[model samples]
Target: MASNGVEKVGVLIVGSGPTGLGAATRLNQLGHPNWLLVDKEADAGGLACTDVTPEGFLFDMGGHVIFSHYQYFDDLLDTAVGQGDAAWNTLERVSYVWLKDRWVAYPFQNNISALDKEDQIKCLAGVVDAKVANAVAQGKPKNFDEWIMRVMGPGIADLFMRPYNFKVWAVPTTMMQCDWLGERVATVDVDRAIANVINNKEDAGWGPNAVFRFPLEGGTGGIWKKVAKLLPPERQRYGCQLAGLDKDKQVATFADGRQVAYDALISTIPLDITLRWLGQSEWADGLQHSSSHIIGFGIRGRCPHGLKCWLYFPEDNCPFYRVTVFSHYAKKNCPADGTKLPTLCKADGSGPDSSEAAEGPYWSLMFEVSESNYKPVAQQPTKLGGSAVAAQGTWPAVVAETLAGALATQLMQPGDEVVSVYHRRLEHGYPTPSLGRDGVLKQALPWLRKHNIWSRGRFGSYKYEVANQDHSLMLGVECVDNILFGTQELTLEHPNIVNPRKNLEMKYTREPVMPGLLASAKPMSAQEN
Candidate 1:
């Protein structure tokens, strides 16, 4: 390790995310020691990290659940987070959509049984049109809005698809492209909808994540923290402020007057930031993204949110599009038994005004609200306390609306006491699959590759379809193979191939490890040591 000066390496990875960690892990397995990994965070889970409030409420960036298709990814999870049964909670996904003041088992189009007769008629008619259109329609969908109509028809689009998607993406369907939809969005089946509605049956098992697992203790962040540990300690650097990148000189300079030169560079940072560093910001001008506000509540009451894992809101009553019953996932999500925390406020904005603390058998709720050019959140948080209320929650004036929204949406009753309020704003949450995304990625990505730099991750690659933690991880693994042995990056180059089929290119199966024997055996990442 070069002490007081520049260091040169065979490969240099910027950002300690799944992508960076995946690359570092692969290189390590390949017996390559001349690689270095650096990140700005003190921790390894970039957007994947978890946060705890002063009152001991745990909140993730958003709701993250793992549904792996790659054996390589499955093996990495075991090596990091571990194969121990105590490390995770295997879950049966119980998701529902809030529509017309009733909870419909999710994939709204398929569960018309829960809808009113009027809605059922409307949706079924639309499905009929879609089936007819599918047979005769030519070329590809011009945009997401057209695609929705072509596949789901006008009735479903008007009643739920259009509004719910707009809330989640913070962009109208008309502005996005349909190519990234792959397995992410469910396609409406005409026969299934008709049968479910007529027979009064529910169809919830539609996607790959029909069953999933989450870390037993920490949120989704726990998995990445483990993977970042499998590299040489001395080569991993954390808390280093990245100043600039001189692409021409093949150098990365830190704010503290240190530099590293690399034969090949792998960046997991957002493409816009990377381009800006390389002094070519214009190439990424067409990119669009939505910001996210994670509003969490630690409550002191009977948990009204039952075994349902998460719920979606399409009505205007709530500021959030989705709310996860966080406490149901793990006991450690909230403060332990009898641990006292000051009551922040009630769900109805009533409270213990002073610094008065109380004990709990607590439960929590985590909400996600999206913002974009069309939908905006406040730049500055409004200075409001327990007695204050906003007319309707808009961005910036968050707290009052969030609380009121909870009450309005019936997630919380008027008497539900709020023990803790946790709010976090993430500037770049979801990468919009906009109509112009492919054009921009095509031009920018190939040019970067020409310079021996591979941008591959959520924002690095700028492909939302392949932006999950697993996909991001494989992008790094594949990029390394492409760098060293010229392997095809099936994950990055073809998301369609990897998203549906279980990629058994690499496979490992293990029986669940016994719990309690190693419950406290937490492995430290390379930098932590």
Candidate 2:
């Protein structure tokens, strides 16, 4: 600690998630020592972290699979936690959408052939109409709903796109924008839809995450914990909350009364919260976000959903929009097969025939439910883990609802034994792309930059298109380069460019000199303070 409890550094990074860690890693790799990293959480990996139940079951905050679009990100993870089968499990994506009581192949627009005869006719006709309308369309889609209609027509939109998205975003499609749908969504092909329906073929592969990797152990958070290890521990501070920011003075005050003055501040905090701290809460109205309710169940039995990594839910039969076979990702996700455990409840949420502990195999399911002002969720006391008591309308009620949903979706049996239950609610889950998002960001980001502050991260920049783990990390890395050398931040500025293809411009190791980042144009001095 500096004397007078006022430390000075070139850059002060807030939040130790992927983005903050990425910024720190880049600064260190470039040999910049006068910087500090702090996070409110006791550990790194913000929303990407994982939680384990007392019965020995691990669950990530949400579905986080690494599908890297940058070689730098790929290399960082490889260096942090070795490469190949030893450190990761490379799995082919086998995803589906559970609707109409049947499993539809993923990229539902491309696989409408899985529907019944009448439904197939309805969807095929819509695709044909959309293609015809698109050929002579007047202007681009005004909102997400318009885009869905233009690409998928009314039948597909009415059946799946609208309902599924409403459940996922917890907001009406009409209230959201469409520019962020670069590669995140799959557009329907009129001819392909027709051909698939005629031949009864399934078009499963469409988007970027066709094949992805998961850490062999410790879940998704394990990867970041290892990445944080690569940085100097003395420079990293965990469990430090930012009380307020003095942008004009270039100083940050912590809740503990510790203050740090920086030449340039790189903040990964949510843009809305940052604005509020800066006393500019008026600009935050344009920013919209949805909350997430993650529920997990550890059951004693052999895995039933074989090779089925994840499945989506669209109907009212379930509360969650998606569920992942967590144990299928890795065996270590569950307790040892022989480990003894008593049943909490049957899949129907009824009392078990016997409460005696028994040894057996184990499997787990993780579910995600979205919530927002537009879509309110049942608020109740959250269940932490491990034999915690929960009554109706609390964690137990939520779990009961989820189990009933599973049974309704045929993912669970009525008498299945649930050994462990876990539930956690993330206040800031997904950064929504609202209709007025771009307008607000255009002003707020530049305004922050003028104050020597760089707001970049999942919620910092608030660009859902580039808010993935890899993109979030690069936001930090690119911000550091921009601050030091005036280098263009591609991931932040040109998400469409960096997202569609591999970004090989930067490397992990300082090897061949890279162009475009002019040293003479370097702005801030790391040793200024």
Score every model by TM-score: 0.91, 0.93
What tens digits encode model 1's per-residue C-alpha lDDT throughout 1-529? 4554678999999888889988887777666759999999888888888999888889989998887766667767876787767788888889999877779998888898898899889889998989898789998989999999999999999988899899999999999999999988999878878999889999997777778888888788777887776667787899986788888778889878889988899998889888877777786677888999998888986587678888888888878899899998888888896998776566777545555677888999999999888998654655323444232123356756777887877888887777777788888899899988898888888888888889989889989999888888878877887898776777788788777734423322222122211121111111110
Query: Per-residue lDDT for 1-529 in model 2, tens only?
Result: 5676788999999988899998888887777869999998999998899999999999999989998776667878988888899999999889999989899999999999999999998888888899999899998999999999999999999899999999999999999999999888998878888898899998896777888899889999999999899888999999899999998888899999889999999998899999988887888888999999999989889988889998899899989999999998888999888899988877776666676889879999999999899988875544322224332124745566787789999999988888888889899999999999999999999999999999999998999999999888889888988998888887788877776633323322222113212233232111110
> What C-alpha RMSD separates each model from the true structure?
5.8, 4.8
Give the lDDT of residue 445 in candidate 1. 88
Q: Report the number of backbone clashes for model 2.
A: 0
TM-score of 1: 0.91
Candidate maximizing lDDT: 2
Query: How much is the lDDT of residue 158 in candidate 2?
Result: 88
What Cα-based lDDT does every candidate model obtain?
Answer: 0.80, 0.85
Give the Cα-based TM-score of candidate 2 against the true structure.
0.93
Q: Against the true structure, candidate 1 has what lDDT? A: 0.80
